[model samples]
Target: MSDEDLRLSADRVLARLVGDPTDSARLREDQWRAIEALVAERRRALVVQRTGWGKSAVYFVATALLRERGSGPTVIVSPLLALMRNQVDAAARAGIRARTINSANTEEWDTIQAEVAAGEVDVLLVSPERLNNPDFRDQVLPQLAAATGLLVVDEAHCISDWGHDFRPDYRRLRTMLADLPQGVPVLATTATANARVTADVAEQLGTGEGTGRALVLRGPLDRESLRLGVLPLPDAAHRLAWLADHLDELPGSGIIYTLTVAAAEEVTAFLRQRGHTVASYTGKTENADRQQAEEDLLANRVKALVATSALGMGFDKPDLGFVVHLGSPSSPIAYYQQVGRAGRGVEHAEVLLLPGREDEAIWRYFASLAFPPEEQVRRTLDVLAASDRPVSLPALEPQVELRRSRLEIMLKVLDVDGAVRRVRGGWTATGQPWAYDAERYAWVARQRETEQQAMREYATTADCRMEFLRRQLDDEKAAPCGRCDNCAGVRFTTEVSAASLDAARGELGRPGVEVEPRRMWPTGLPAVGVDLKGRIPADEQAAPGRALGRLSDIGWGNRLRPLLAPQSPDAPVPDDVAGAVVTVLADWAKGPGGWASGAPDAPDRPVGVVTIASRTRPQLIGSLGERIATVGRLPLLGSVAYHDGEIDTRVPRTNSAQRLRALHGALTVPPPLAAALAEAGGPVLLVDDLADTGWTLAVASRLLRRSGAAGVFPLVLAVQG
Candidate 1:
């Protein structure tokens, strides 16, 4: 078709996409250019436009035109389930039959795949993670790639490790891109890539060596409707209180982003108590709850959805009037993408940043989960190479020191690098030569540090906040956005009501997070030389326990994180923390299921106290044990001793299997401690500075129980969520 004829057809499709046949919703010139490239030129393209710039329109219109010409379905690789849902609904409005095959709708996979095979589906939306699934990658992906007419990679920044939100699964797209049929058109798009990331993604899209390189369509990253501001508060309490006091004063219902899931729940609860309608959305939220939360927010049924990054990327609500961050994101690029959720189809929207002292701690925690070192990566490859059959992740965990999540990520990256391949049963070594990219990994780490420093500057910069963020993304047209608080004079108040502040403090100040005991042993413990498997014996199991606070909590967490940090000095518990521990114990004793609750199921009161022998924080643990024993008038039974007085430092930060293996014969109930336990005659309080993975607590509790203690009640200063 001629350009003029294509433009006329695309215009009508655009009107249908907007749900108004009578509305003259013609595609913008850039959007038209993109469609023209994909349909007329049959060329690859990268559209780096700002959010709500109608990137989706280019693809939807292209899909309609392609299907009209009897081309195969358009397969879009989206990053989030929320994004896929919005696109599916939007496609329906354009009279295109859209279907999705994601983790959430596994039951419909067969039907959806059949429909696509039969050419009954015009668009198929898939998640990036699906690209690496064993069955999907080996069985479905090739077929889809061969037949796909127009391939769209949404949020393409994820394909580059330099991108703020890189995922290993996204990089797997290279193989699919390289294998595409000749003349097949591909389009990659994102709103948060700087020059480096854009170049990297474009290079990946150029895998078809003989084909012309991807056309790059870059635009300015500025949101005129967003009125940016920063409200620096005293602490988490004040920041949360400010939200409670002034949330209604903000434009329309919108998101309030938190740095952690604990904070999300905390904020949602406090906001609801303050008479605001709110819901929490986090990675841990069930798919049904997430879908419901999105619906409620889109329909304005709830004032806001207190969310984490789980709600970011591709949640489409054009009239969203505000985007507030309770704590600043670690990168300014990330911050821009999140705030871009607001003011898409409206004249005005509020974007406020309430930076907290705890932001750095949260950032550091996430940073720690980055790709493992060269040694660990090599070890994983060696293990997989030695395996005769495909080894499942659980079976592989004992041999690898990395945690499950981290290990999965490493395997995905290796799979993409051709060192390993995920197979029917599990993963297998491909016997391919794989060299560790130490320099590249180091560069990425340094880039992360630089981004973190830039985020710090963003929070305190006196210049235009939008310009600062735009420049972070290498936007050449970045200038002072006159709508920001700094550019337009401060627009939001830092003041909050005394009652709301107190309520927030009280809510956050309340201590005690439940620490559930480990009920089952880590899989493949025997492979690590530990004689353990299946369910932990009931008699050996520790009862549900309590910690003073979560390290991720907004209130007590802020106080406990420093005290429990790995580098923190081994000092005795501070008075304020001790006092909070006492308050928690008192509340626990009188609350349901407590020893002093007077309920039928409540356990007998503690008769003694025992401490976990800490290799690093002996002073803290020893003093805490004595303090608790003295306060309860109970005997201070000696600590659980390390075997032969030797410590296993490797047990502190490892996966469950490795930790348990190192701990299997590493801890013992010495005769003195056992005798003391026998004399105590009843349950003893187990004291530790922190509980992570719960393996240490379980081992120590079992030692005490077998040594004649009636029961174990574990207590800790902090818990890792």
Candidate 2:
């Protein structure tokens, strides 16, 4: 029969099977037009679209239409056994005849093959690995070559090296299609692909340029309901603590992603200890265990799940409310896919990235480990090339002396290069040259390097974290999302009180203080104040007038010095100067009742205290002193009042503005240079080198107030106001 006449007869058979003489299934207009053109011209076609864009719907409806026209039986090639089962189940739901062939059906395989050869099976779904069976080619292909109506390749991106999930067996599909009878329509579908992947899909399906055809349906990449955020923390422990605090606030199904199988187990154990029913899935898990874990999550037996990235592909549960990465992935594409798993049904979802300094290092190590040496590549090629047909890894391993771990890594690399195809229990050489050019391997290596660099940059960048990620993905045009850590305006704050400063300065400037090599102390060290001279000596020095002037040249003349001592003068003061120096005063000494006492020697042990100027406002000072006195045995250092004239306010405020003036007063307090300052019972002293209107001091005092601080007192070396 002529090609046209055979095509006409096939159309009649397809119409009868699908029950739709004219397909009216809703599909993107462009895709519909492309399919119609394919059918009209009697040529093969491939369609690629983003995930959730209805690629399956297009092919399924088209299959129905073609079948209604009496087209011969159609065949579908899929990668996963579960996906094949899903397809068969879906067809059954639609009241169409469909069957699947895989390793699970040992006894039924021959019967199914015979049924397909006899045109008794309307649709047959099989894995690419199954097609490598010689019987399929010798028997099924000839029959299908004569009457095959349609061939569909789902998740066609798997055939391309550029795709996230590359499969070796997919490479042989083009050769298999070439062997099929001319004008037997081919339809390929996939959810995600970039330009390179798109080209690869077309080429692998034997639908290139003019001989065959391709149609791409683009969809919006943005997911409005998916809120993205990144959190920077000192360590994983802190991250766990943060998650613990926020877990209750984040209700609904959630997935916490970790980088390693061990981390997944660790985090899951930690969460379980905290009373959360958590399940973990990682590569180390047995298939039965993984399946059970997935089922438990789906059945709501667990509210939270901790897993490695292996849990996501082909597992569809629509209500996932959150996806959090315990560490950053190597590329934005990897992250995008993992996060995309959440909110698949278009519900509001949140994705958080909790990263630390070690995350990048771990990923780089893994990448280096995953990159196989050229020798391993050569061996993989040699073995596959020697095999007349595909050889299973189990059989090939006997010939290669490399460890299985190393061998598998090499196989994955070769699979990505399209040098060999993975068949059921074996590996097949496609007989076609590797799709990648020599430079392509270098490009992939560089791409991996770039991805690692991008991940490191994402973790370390000071800019808006989300903006950095969006830009890395070539989505720079996207606006800054306001929900991330950068947008939320959270920062670390350390408040140094006058008491802590004096204590640190006393220890650092003590005569023969016997400073430890590391300055390590059994108890924590106290905060210390530094003079304008920025030097520390055992003894008091002349007024640092000139040094203070020099400090004023910089805006930091009023800034607090954390851990520096002021320079001493040529002259020395006696060590016996008792009350002149405010030592570490006890918290009780500053409270109401303890205000009656004067500065005493350092307590044998640690005690929280603040020494205020005696000349300062008594009510304010006394109230603080009384609060300090509540520490009982810890003596309250009587409020040492300072001459109002010695104090300066950079920003002046009226007495009626108690809030502002008080805030200003606290910010200008002089600090004893120290890394950290502790507060007494109630009032905390905030010291700055210079002070303006004390807005910063006031704001900080407000923060302390929220922390149950009685009040804030300010001390400054210089005052502009």
Count of clashing residue pairs in every prediction = 0, 79
| Best model per TM-score | 1
Residue 428 lDDT, candidate 2, scale 0-100: 72
Model 1 pairs whose backbones collide = none
What does candidate 2's lDDT look like per residue over 647-690, in tens digits?
Answer: 33323231212223333334322333111232443444432333
Model 2 — TM-score against the truth? 0.56
Structural similarity to truth (TM-score) of each candidate: 0.99, 0.56
lDDT: which candidate is best?
1
Candidate 1 Cα errors over 4 Å, as ranges: none
